[model samples]
Target chain A: MSTLGLIFRELRHHKANAALVVLALAGTVALLVAVRILATAAERETRRVTRDLGFNLRILPRDVDPDQFLADGHSDKTLPADAVTRLAAAAGTFVSFNHLTPSLERRIQLGGRDAILDGLGPSVVGPGEKKQPMGFNIPSGKAYIGHALAQRLDARPGATIDVKGKALAVERVLVESGTDDDIRLYTSLADAQSILGLPGRISEIRAIDCLCMTGEQDALAQLRNALERSLPEARVLQIRAIADARARQRQTAEKYTAFAVPLVLIVGAAWVGILAALNVRERRPEIGLWRALGNGSVRIASLVLGRAVILGVAGAAMGYFVGTQLALQAGPRIFPVTAAGIVADPSLAWWALLIAPGFAAVASFLPAMLAVAHDPAETLRAD
Target chain B: MVSCDHLVRTFAARAGTVAALDDVSFRVERGEFVAIHGASGSGKSTLLLTLGGMLRPTSGAVSIDGRDLYSLSAGARTRFRASTIGFVFQLFHLVPYLDVRQNILAGVPRPDADARARVDRLIEELGLGPRAESLPSTLSAGERQRVALARALAKQPPLILADEPTGNLDPVNAGVVFRRLADYQRAGGTVLVVTHGNDAAPYATRTLRLDHGRLAARLTTEVL
Candidate 1:
């Protein structure tokens, strides 16, 4: 028989053995794909979450006394009349900023119970701030309320709420966002300042800018720097850094997969080896005959390994398809806010296809080599 | 032409080192059909394996067409065997899964036009054309041996080695196996047949008998 033909036949004979190897490799590749998808999904979700929360950077006073700021907890700070314009102008030098605060407090009865009132607003920066229109466009006197607060207060869109004893219109009921500041209400900067009776005072400012760092370090550093520069003494606080949190979650997921992938591979290799070795042992006489007729070590190795590769490829392909279904199911459950509300990562499942074949080849190495190493003469003499 | 000079083969089993062949010397020229007759455990099979280069003799020189088999590197020896020799066993060690045609083609160097043609011709000559696609398990003893013979001749090797080519066949089928061997000889191919069957004596150009791992007697065609 031809070398390749012989190899094909050998593999065909040991189909089950080869299949086992392929299955193992497919599992490894699937694991790799899953971890990859989870990681990418986590990243995508973080970005979406950040956008939904309405801010990237929180700007506060750099030189204010920390003791005094904390003493006025949750209360409006009375800065100089020009303090908001000055801080806005300085921040405008480097980046865009939007300042916001609770405008009016609403006391409403819902289900015969009193409801808590909170407010949100867009911050005001200098006219030099890029994208000035979007930063300034907050429907004045209109407000958005949290779903929980709305439910408790029986609040509806366009309904009026008693904010600090003044009637204010509720524009929309906010979705339940999973962030630290989700329970509060939101309104325009001008309206919040007027109703809170703290004119020229701003609680927080949001900045939309990009930074270049990867993982937790980048995120923590960016938050620390923005808060330190904008509100050094004011004690800059962040609602949450989604990217860093997701990164941590992905890291934890990958760590477990890393441990599991190799364990599966090891077990798979062993199982394939045992099966192949037994096959070779059983075929010793035939192998001896072929060797005596003139086949070489390489030919014999091919005969054994070729069978394994075929099986490996089949199993891997099956596993990849299964993994794709799994990813589809997982995407929606994990992050339901993307374009399709499902992960569309281009690099998601493609790498797995290539890795499956290599896994099969690797799994067959020892058995194929061992088969060729047996002495033809000794085997023929074994009776 | 193939010749063995001062060949010594020993096996180191768990008990002790046992000598299978000791200082055995012999020679056979091209186109000669020689019979090596020996009783069981008389090293007839060991001689065949040694000549096939499957076993490394303890001390010896085996020369095929003036090239010492042992002196060649392992890879070179393998190539030499592929191009120069064909072997057949008494049990007809056909791969059970492959059909008759594939079993015959197994001896040929892959994809060689001349080898392919040679196999085709042998299959036709041995009357296996109709059974070419039949597995060995379904073939009769004589037909299986014919397939084995076709395989040996397929490579057009200079030397043919047969170890009891008809040992498993009845007298009638044994004669059929011998006829194929005789036809091979007529085609100018040198062959060595190792067997205890005295019935094979008539077909050999010369017969050498072995006793106790030593050459005992040589009888020519005229004597037979």
Candidate 2:
């Protein structure tokens, strides 16, 4: 028999004890992997929600009510087209700017039903304006509708539909925002104005205030100062609640991720360490017998350490598989992602697989030492 | 050939240090089956352990084939024990996890074809052919001791050291163990065994008796 075969024989002799060690190790690795994935998923979900909120700060006329903007649809405080244009110029590389001029009441008839048809002008984004989920870069004679509206009208991209006596091609369908975005249809500024017979008029100019994960603290202050200096007619609306909530959301996500990973590692190491020590204790006599049978201290140590290697690696591999399944099923359910939005973050997974066995090995170090420390003369002499 | 020159082994207790082998000495030639007889606690096991390099002597030295055993490093001494000396215990130190064949094979670090043949022959000679694949737990006292003896001879070492080899066996099984040791002596190998009584006296070419860890003078038994 081979040297490795000797270790296997010992395992078979103490099958229940070996299984206990393996199970404890597997649980440790599985929990560690799950915690890491949850942390990553939390951060990713925060970013996705922040992007879906469209714009953080909106530049509306001074008369616009802070609390009633959603109900008024920015139509209660109208701004001229040139005023919107110069405000974009004044912002100058500091923001992503878009102008909106709704259809009078901002609700129109489409496919024989009343729907929100907002006249959205093209957005002016800086060279480094990371993402523009709601930029609304509309062109003439084409339109984008929300997922609910498309479903109601059975409309798809590239199909033409009659809108107020004019044929417009369906450009794209937006994902469900779970808000009024579901009932809204955004048409080009020129098309909406001509159709409403109110050319060169806009309800409001919207500005996404920051370039970072959030735009609440210094970015919001800078925007207030910029607008006060240049476009005094428009006061930067803080959008009240979203401004504060976004910053708090991001901070909580990052902190949770940081705190959870280390905690998982500590728990996993503890489980493996205790169980490995017990496993060594259970095999003390076997170790002594091997020593008495003309095997040296080094060979005895190899037998113990070899068992640790197998348990560590085997437990880690099994944990990776089980943990991935758990993460996949739980991630989308937690984030409410309808599609397969599980970003596995392969780098993190690779680290888990690499570190799990390392936990097992390091945990077994003291136990392996204890195994070789037995007095063969006394131990073998015992019944 | 083996020689022990004034070997002294001491153990310390809370009260004082006591010598297990008090200035003891002996010499044995090749192919000599010598039995060292003593009562319990006569330090017969200590003498065998010191000679086998399993225990270190506090003073003096043991040399096998002109090489000083105590002069070598700890690692070298272990290797010397594994490659040159074979050991059998009163309790029959057979690995319970392994079958008789594997227990025999366990003595050889890496058993090649010749080593494997040596183990097979020892198993057959010990009358353990049918029980080669059986675990030691299932074997009788005689069979277990025979397996232990086979394991000791697995490497075909130049010397065999058996401490109370038949101490745990019945009279019939004790006779079985002595006959095997006698046969090994006839094959031109040195054998040194420790026993509490005359169970192995008929098989030994000479007997060295010990009392209170000291060799008794005029203690020799010549078998014609």
Candidate 3:
């Protein structure tokens, strides 16, 4: 018989034992894989949402008169034209700036229908900003409307909509940024400032981005200090990294695995060992005769271990099947949806299935060791 | 081809160290059929174990082919045992879960073609072909013993150690087993049998009688 054939024969001898071990290992691997996917997808979704909203740090004059804009039915909070230059000089890097005011309740005419307009814009952004989920840039007299807001205003691209008495044509529809994208609009900073009638006053300087060291606490401290020194009047904030978000979710997943994996491994080991012990006890004379017949300690040990490997392998295979079924069934709901669509990675679950059985074999080793360490002669001679 | 000098075996039980075999020594040459006749606790099995390299001698040397067994490392000794010796038990300790053929093959190092062919030939010669696919539980006491012999012979070892190889056999199967051992000897294999039965003593070239932890006599068949 081939080595595997012999092992298979031995494993088949104890059906119940093999099943238990495989189930334990499969369950552990499945749990680990699922949690990993969950954590990863959550991180991805968080970053997607954050990036879609634009501007990790939003800065404005610390005190802005809200009543001035409200009473006059229009307001502009435009900063000085040199504000971007100043921030660029202070940060030692050129920084892009966008001017925006949150949408105020007001009326707009879409076609012949009057509807409440909810749009804010006239923001300048860096190169990559336009591609973000909820970001857009337009020239004067044009606007990008949210899907929900556009539907409410009966507005489509190329259609004119009145925003606070200033008429602008819709340039595009902002699709799928969840609820936030549905309620906002996009316009050029100049147009927003002009419409709001506050040409010299900017509402808030929307700070684009500055990449920095994530792991080095001292570097982060220095960077924070630098931002403070550079934009002293504007509060500086650090945006969370995609890596940090992923790591946090992964940490939560790892915590679950740390507690659960050992339990599964120990249970798998014990199950194989207990069954093997019983098998050995039942075949005491046979084991003895093997030793007496010149089967060395290693051979006897192999015979015992071979049996456990068989069981472990069988169990791992079974568990893998069960786990994959679970992952496929549950994976979609956890990720929910992405900007593109629902996110799922089936290969990760399959990888878990393939890796679990090897672990099962390892778990069986301890039990195999205990069962093979017997005195052949004495065991054989006993009734 | 085998010798033991002043061998001692002790086991520490809950009650303390008990001497199972004390200062025992004997030898068997190639092609010799030797029977170690002893009553219970007379150390016949212990002597067999020490010779087989399964049990280490506590106080003396046991050698095969002029090489001291204890002098070899643990792994080497195991290889030595696998290559040089085969074992048969009176109780027919076949692995019951495996089919007869598989149990027979299990005696060999692994599932080599030669081992399988040897086992197949042994099965046919021993009239076990009809039962080869069956488990041990399906075989009679005599058939089980025959299967056990087939397993032992599968390795084609130079030495055959039988711990009461015919103990569970009836008179008819006992005669068959004894004749088989004689045939093995005729083929130039050494046979050392530990037994309580004196009925097979005439078939032995020499009888080493064990009584109360010592070899009482090395009697030839004529003398017996």
* Recovered native contacts, candidate 3: 0.39
User: Largest DockQ belongs to which candidate?
Assistant: 1
What is the descending TM-score order? 1, 3, 2
Candidates ranked, most accurate by lDDT first: 2, 1, 3
Docking class of predicted structure 3: acceptable
For candidate 1, what is the TM-score?
0.76
Identify the superior model by TM-score, candidate 1 or candidate 2: 1
Please give, for residues B12-72, the per-residue lDDT of candidate 3 as tens digits.
8899987778788877898999998888778877877778787887789999989899899
TM per prediction: 0.76, 0.71, 0.73
Quote the chain B TM-score of every prediction: 0.94, 0.95, 0.94
* Higher-lDDT candidate of 1 and 3: 1
Error of 3 at B206 (Å): 2.2
Q: Give the Cα-based TM-score of candidate 3 against the true structure.
A: 0.73
Candidate 1 lDDT over A161-211, as tens digits, reads 766656668888877765423445566666666766666565544453333
Q: Mind giving the per-residue lDDT tens digits that candidate 2 earns over A69-133?
A: 76756556666767655765664435533322222226777666768877777665554555443
Number of the top-ranking candidate, with TM-score as the measure: 1
